[model samples]
Target: MKYSISWLLLLLFLPFAASAQTENPVYDEIAPFNEGLAAVRVGNQWGFINENAQMVIDFRDDLVWNQDADTSIPGVLGIRYPQFKNGRCMIQKLKVNNIPFYGFIDTSGEIVIQPEYLNITEFDQENAIGIYVREMYQGQNEIKLDIVEYIFTEVVVNINGEIVWPIMEREHALTAKRRYEVPKLRAKLIGKDLLEFKTEDNKWSVKKLNLNL
Candidate 1:
């Protein structure tokens, strides 16, 4: 009687395969659906996976989140939550790479906005504001505190590289007191879809306003 080697091999490996399956079966926890997909945490990284447990966006980062439509697109006016929009998601890249920079990435994981800004704030009034700061030091001792002067400035930018508005020299200082006494500049979204900045000095100005809503 000739013994079939292939059958014998299959029988010998079957128990090992069954044991492997029993010990290492894949376990999946469903992720919450957002914008037609969901982000899942696998091991230590987070990525977007579809309902079928297939990876839509591979896990590559320490953290991840979704962005909604208003937050993803440029020029939409209104507050947007921290999530992805229009295939672009905001993420914090490497922290040790320098100043913690926040930028947007497409679904393909391409960075649309390079991480270069110092800080990215929550969407406010239809715009996400980025802040960059320059710090100056003044050696003011207790005896000669009034003699020393310190100045600080903050530059704000939008995703489109537009300077929506700037808080000038003295006004940039967080502790500044009445540095520029110019009347409070009031920003109003006017009828023509323009931002009308009116000052008490009768200086009427107009700029296109990006409404996120």
Candidate 2:
């Protein structure tokens, strides 16, 4: 029996072809893999793809406004990047009236928190994230349509989505912010036990995150 040269070449390349199918499959858009999976966009829908290139989470399930009648003809170009920290990733969706809201989803693709908040940061190992609600304010410049500000209203929440701190008063929150000489107080590390806040004062302070103040 004589084996043709083409047949021999095909056999030699089959293993590589099979590997290509399962390894680093190219995607139109991809995000950095967090934990074991990363968010990927197929046209307009978003879903999670695992390291092995498996579609662990269906894109349709978590996509924002994909099935809505009011979705733009072009659709949203991209959803927020998915970065799984402490097994929870932030996801976005449209409100019943067609407004955008944010929420959290677990690695299993379950909605851990319903999409209701206006803005959210990724939860840390402490199960804490900064939740901001949009507030319109009067600005010194009247030429602009309106001035927008974020009150650290619900500053922190545990992984279970329970408020660690009660709702912060807008006036009080602003007053407290002014105390720090720093122009901006940035929270670098938000651990459960404590948070490290650094101020433009060029000084760092460890404040108990659940301060009643």
Candidate 3:
């Protein structure tokens, strides 16, 4: 009976000891409750820690920030970042091993989806909208005058990376325009009538399509 009692006490104390060791660094900042995760900055790197002060996600990238305004987490174009949806946090990042690509990963650090396209947005209702740009090139000195074609594709990916449905494809163009003495290319999503693409060109014309559609 005494051995059993001691075993129970040890089990109870083990959890507390583990919790104490997992305390988040004071300098590490946590996001609001809505953000679902906290971003802690250690030295020159940044990572994520759960509410229990446990290091759920380790520091890996040079710039780690959140995109949610309420929580002020790091947001970058290519790096994978966590986002809150339906009270649950989802992580999305650009996976470009070859050409520019994008994909999504779940909270448990599993690649639920594989990287395949040029760009991807965070999943909403198991659906994500993406855009692909094909650059138009000219010869030698004329290459500078080349244009870019932007295509929009919407896909539905389940938590297991299964494609449930494929949506229609839309295309748009980008033209050069002068902004503050600098030439920039602006794209408009054709059917949806949204401004979706932006780059430097030199003159104004509708050539690139936005992805919001």
Candidate 4:
């Protein structure tokens, strides 16, 4: 019997493919793939693996968890592992006071944004708006810390973690003619490199954005 070239190639590669499948470490849980990678857990540590079953991100015990998760149900995972979106993932670091700081990592598991912002939104195309806060501390008790005065500004950041522009305040973004309010602190990219916004007169305005996305 004569076998086709494709069949012969498959026969030659079958053992290697089976070996690769068997080489994957036993994971406590594996989440569905998001953007070509999936979150895998061993004990309490979590990491990511690509479609090829190669561990791209090393397992770390410090990855954030879902504080309010109820894992009693079957097939439910408690930990809130980072998932890639638009080729970037959000990671959280806890401060000394247990406060959460947010940052972003590229697809290669390299830190693209340092965990410094008070809060940040997921990347919309090539830009994301984050809240930068300056707080005046009041005091801290056994339960929580008191922050009396918080001065925050919403700023726009590129994929390289550089602050390119400060988003206009909501009041300023509101149109005088129609009283149109900006929905939220978000930047939605249009086409290739355009940002659309509502002007003071309630007219649509489009500006060209040169970003490092």
Top candidate by lDDT: 4
lDDT of 2 by residue, 102-162 (tens): 6777878888877655444566664554434445686756676656564545456666676
Cα error, candidate 4, residue 174 (Å)? 26
lDDT of each: 0.48, 0.58, 0.44, 0.65
lDDT of 3 by residue, 1-213 (tens): 999999999999999988776662465444543345665665555566666767776765423244443332111243233444332233334332223344544555454555544444454454444443334444445656545334444433344555443433434322222211111112323332222343345343443332334
Candidate 1 ranges with C-alpha deviation above 4 Å: 1-31, 51-53, 62-82, 95-99, 122-126, 133-213
Model 4 lDDT tens row, 1-213: 356887999999999989877896789888889989998888877899999988999987645545464444111122355567688777777652555666778877788888766556666677766655545677876688664544555667777887786655442321233453223433334544576655657667777766543
Instruction: Report the C-alpha lDDT of model 1 over 1-213, residue by residue, as the tens digit.
Output: 246887898899999999888765352334456556666555545677555655666766623333343443222222232244444556665432232345666666666666544344433333444443444556677787634333432233444544555533334323333342212223443443455654447587876644443
Model 2 quality (TM-score): 0.56
Instruction: Compute the lDDT of residue 108 as modeled in candidate 4.
Output: 76
Better of 1 and 3 by TM-score: 3
lDDT of 2 at 19: 86
Could you report the Cα RMSD, in angstroms, for every candidate shown? 10.3, 11.2, 10.6, 11.6
Error of 4 at 58 (Å): 1.2
Q: How many clashing residue pairs, candidate 3?
A: 16
- Winner of 2 and 3 under TM-score: 2
State every prediction's TM-score relative to the real structure.
Answer: 0.43, 0.56, 0.43, 0.55
Q: How does residue 203 of candidate 1 score in lDDT?
A: 81
- Candidate 1 structure, TM-score to reference: 0.43
Best model per TM-score: 2
